[model samples]
Target: MANPAVMVLGATGRIGRLLQLCPPQGLHLRLQARRAQAGNSTGDWHIFDPRAEPAALARAAEGAAVLLCLAGPVPGRGGADADMADHVRLGEAAVRAGASAGARVLLASSAAVYGARGGLLAEDAALRPASAYGAAKAQMEARAAALGAELGVPVCSLRIGNIAGLDAALGGWRPGFTLDRFAGGRTPRRSYIGARTLAEVLAALLAAPVLPPVLNLAQPGAVEMGALLQAAGRPFAVRAAPAAAIPEVALDAARLQALLPAPLAAADPVQMAAEWALLEPEMAER
Candidate 1:
């Protein structure tokens, strides 16, 4: 039997770059991007703009066992309509392509779909998006699920939580950017997963024969902003916001944990921060 071919859209973003750096073994990766760059064309890369070339996108997904839709507009970068439209189109395209090829579609949805709701958020929680970005993701998830059911394609929406990256918990902190406190000067708690752990989970999901329709991807425990900042050895000041004003999403990842072979350890925010600090200088030199 041949290795399964996997297609990854938006193969140049932050998570995409991490996937490239630490690629999963035993799979043929077809990384797709909107445009070709100088150094990003080594592997099986296909440049197909979903906006311009719908056929090209389908072609890229053909003969693949899994189609991972990671392409979407960044929050705060464009108008709400434009951002929403971008993801809507991408989700539609992915469903059409995956249905045609009989490939399992995995859409990377955001935990922001739950809005500012505190407490344990399950996969079945009501979606009440606070921001435009959250609204767009909720719509995207709906569209993908509807299309998958209509077209008889296996589709899974992963509601991912805060991902700790190199610059996230370990880098230099700015006033408002790094420290976000809720009302009464309390640090908001949020579920987080390390970048490497996220990649590994994604790879495992790709290999699974059966998948749940929706699952929350997060670590076991939650982390606070103050703890993260202190772990990074950065001094920061917090501005108090209204109670429950700051969106703090904590996910219950029991479903995902059961799927994995071993226990998915909770991400230690401070440890991840320290590790990133150690790796920052080395990464910069490369």
Candidate 2:
């Protein structure tokens, strides 16, 4: 049998670049970038502008078995309202293109859709998004699901958790990003997945014969912010602070684990931090 043809939108984003780095075997990749770049020489490249040229999106999705919509407005580049609107628009376009091509659509969604909800949030949790970004994701998922049903195409929304990359996690902080704290003076717990693990899970999902309507893509266990910071060689400051009612955002990824071929081990924050420490210098030079 010929390798399955996979069309990937948002091929220049962080998740898209990771997919490029370790592409799945036995699959033909078709990558779509918003603008043409001179140096990229991998896969079938298409200059797709979902908003400006919907026809281009349909053309790129032709004869594909799976369409992964990883497209979204770059974070922190635009106002929250504008970005959210763009996400909804892009999602609608992606669903239309994939449905027209008779392909299963995978929407890369976010756990933020649950918003300020504490404990193990399952796929069926009510979406009460606390922020604009979270609300946007919720809207995207809803639109995709409705479009897929209307067009008779299978759609899966992967509600991904924190993609704690080497630098992003170890650097302690970044502009426009904040860590959550619980009311009891403890660091808020969050479900997190390493970048490599995230890529692997995505590959597995692409290959699965059956997919759930929604799945939480997170590691088995939650990580404490204090533990993670300490593991990254940073001081844990909120240890003695007064506790607030901040919600601990932990996802229950049991459904995802059941679909994978092998069982997933719980993530080790300290080990992950150590690995990132070693690779930080190397990543900086590139």
RMSD of each: 2.6, 3.2
Q: What TM-score does each of the candidates earn?
A: 0.90, 0.87
Candidate 2, residues 125-174, lDDT tens digits: the string is 99988777788889999988898889888889889887666323444465
lDDT of each residue in 1-286, candidate 1, tens digit only? 8789999998876667767766777888899988887677488999988667878988888899999988888764445545566777788788888988889999888888899887899998899999877888888888888989999998888899877653343343565564566766667677888767777888898888889999999889888867777776677776666554664668998999999878798769776676465545534443
Q: What lDDT would each prediction earn against the true structure? A: 0.79, 0.77
Q: Note the residue pairs that clash in candidate 1.
A: none
**Cα shift from native, residue 13, model 1 (Å):** 0.9
The C-alpha stretches of model 1 lying farther than 4 A from their native spots are 77-82, 166-178, 274-286
Q: Give the distance in Å from residue 8's predicted Cα in candidate 1 to where it truly belongs.
A: 0.4
